[model samples]
Target: MVKRNIISVLDMKDDMPQLVELAEKLKKERGNHGEPLRGKTLAMIFEKPSTRTKISFDVAMSELGGHPLYLSARDMQLDHGETVEDTARVMSRFVHGIMYRAFDYKMMDRLGDSATVPVISGLDNLEHPCQALADMLTIKEHLGSFKGKKLVYLGDGNNVCNSLLYACAIMGVDMIACCPAVRMPNAEIMLGAARIADQNGSKILASHEPLEACVDADILYTDTWVSMGDSTSEEVAVKIFKKYQINQELLDIAKPDCIVMHCLPCHRGQEITDDVIEGPHSVVFDEAENRLHAQKAILLTLLK
Candidate 1:
């Protein structure tokens, strides 16, 4: 009887707090696999590859008493040129919900339009809803409240940054994305985030100078320089982004107790240094662990 939430950076200013509250309660009362989704099924489709998005969602479903049908795009009729909408319609007949990790945001939208059941966007070039959910959960756990906390993201302004902008904005967390102009998040996403920030008493900032952004942040985050499906321009990318690396110096500029985070499979020396990532203040593992609990909340919201 619940509705769907597919994209990460929509006008999701209000829904997040309720979800966060639910996820917090769920995490503390672990091992209680509630029967909210005892008879329902979740179909997870991965067009693009992922580690956290795939495992976290699968585990979340099982823990919520729902059966998860994990399938890759290569495993289905879509491999033989079947239309995405057709596949979505057929899957809707069998499953209570669908979750997709795809290259295009439109693919998830197509699936949503075609299916009677709700669809979740596991990831795409534009948004990573589930990942952002986990990020918020991690932030809330560590810093108590994100209000007035500053976060500096020093890497490619890809999907991760795109979603985090909204999550931070809605939670009253200030964000600074220090990346090359070409790599900044989508303009549309930034504009939408401004409205959310205005309503929630937060801000989104961008700058070419990494130190300027990192100076007083409570958290420093980064992602891979080269995204999936982008294989060209290594020399130019290095030339353009070398200044934005999260080394010990930049970390020093941040608050003394500031934590470092990266959504991994990281390139150690490229986006972030070994000393900082392996340092005491690094909470990357906590973020990874919260993926399960946050996903549990999303499934409960949709299928329960």
Candidate 2:
């Protein structure tokens, strides 16, 4: 049987066409198709604070005629030293699928390995394939296609950046990751993206300077310098990511009307400035809303 969960963008293209078609269907049938997951239960376990992932998945499951059971790490046996594999085995017997957002990618893998039913990675430390789906949908909606588009990613090379690399590579979108050396994407992930890019006529290039990446870029994107598991020290975040901020000067380097994007829950002053994020070209909120539509597509393709 085919596993239905999304763990990383790597090894993920098999269901993409189906996923995109479902996204289109969900867009048309938002007010209906409310019974797609009737009698199905989705277990949503959270290991981090979220506004979008939590709300989107809950609403998506319910709207599709499924029940979503939300649980946090602190409230589960995870706090009592329960293994994720055990949790996965148990939840599989109770729920039709499992969606978890965790601070570590390995935990999600273990859970997926043990589940009898489908397991969805709501998120993990290293990749966010769902968010990338939404971002790609938004870009396609705005640009009419993904082929040959110049997408630039500016900021710390974190999960969002890695996800974008995979998305751009898959869809033939040329991408440049502008980040400091220390914050660049993992070498293996980069190599994987590059290999895909070579086949798809896209490219994944990285540079330490922002202006170089932003040059002739059609889309400018960023994520927070520090994410959920990081130490919440303002000074440390600022110091580490000083060179990667997307400000007005960097904006000027891109096309005149280039779109700006963030994954949301942004630390405004750190990764992006107030004007750029709220500016005329910003599409961050639209990207956020697509989270609902895109993940719905993912659920249907993998679990329906």
Candidate 3:
């Protein structure tokens, strides 16, 4: 059988709903499925710092009867001299699968290309597939279906937005990417998502005005203005994104029951306000917690 990879949301196109369904089941009954991955080992390589990604994967593997070996960039030779392909090939012999959170998107591709086992992208500069999975599951829990709801993403059109665009397209949810034109998502991803959206009867919109995008939105989402490997100063990014903050005023423009979401490590007062993040409308913690269940579904799908 061909080894599958979850390097981007596009990778889960046909299996999106299946994964979400599995995630929901796993959430409600964590131990319903006996450990399918007993004695298996997963190698997690982190080229960047993390809180949720690291702990969630570790716990997910443990709960699934697998071991997760956390390897930082400093712990691995990839930073000093080794090539990603060699690292992947070497680890494939010892581990059941590999999950990598890195800066370069191509390195994840290289690992997938070289490794005999499954390769999962925890996060990269281009896309974040796992986060999108959790986001979809969370939306499903709240809104029942994606048929009529609109998800408005505000702030820098970075990796999270890119994956969300793909997820929304595959799941038939209308999505409006609300960000400055200069900070629009990758053109190739937009083109691909647009194709999928067009065929599925879901609209993919890009708007510069937050109010225009948030109008009647069922979900309002945002991410950090400056990401893990981003070089832009917080000061600069804050200024550029000051107008895009998701606060009460912005929430007023959306549906009365609109839910707030952030793929966390939020810059509280910058991309979102403290009140909104801690308010009754926020489900950021649910999104964070679903990471474990959603990723367990991913692991079972790819590894079992």
**Among these predicted structures, which one has the highest TM-score?**
3
Worst 10 residues of 1 by lDDT: 2-11
Backbone clashes in candidate 3 total 0
Estimated TM-score for each candidate: 0.95, 0.95, 0.98
lDDT of each: 0.84, 0.83, 0.92
Q: Candidate 3 — which pairs collide?
A: none
C-alpha RMSD (angstroms) for model 1: 1.5
Task: Give the per-residue lDDT digits (tens) of candidate 2, residues 118-178.
Answer: 7777778888988988888888777788887898887678888888898888888999988
Per-residue C-alpha lDDT of model 1 across residues 76-115, encoded as one tens digit per residue: 8852578888998899889999988888888777777788
Question: Which one wins by TM-score: 2 or 3?
Answer: 3
Q: Give the TM-score of candidate 2.
A: 0.95
Worst lDDT run of 10 residues, candidate 2, spans 11-20
Query: Distance (Å) between predicted and true CA of 97, model 3?
Result: 0.1
Better candidate by lDDT, 1 or 3: 3
Shift in Å, residue 240, candidate 2: 3.1
Give the best candidate by lDDT.
3
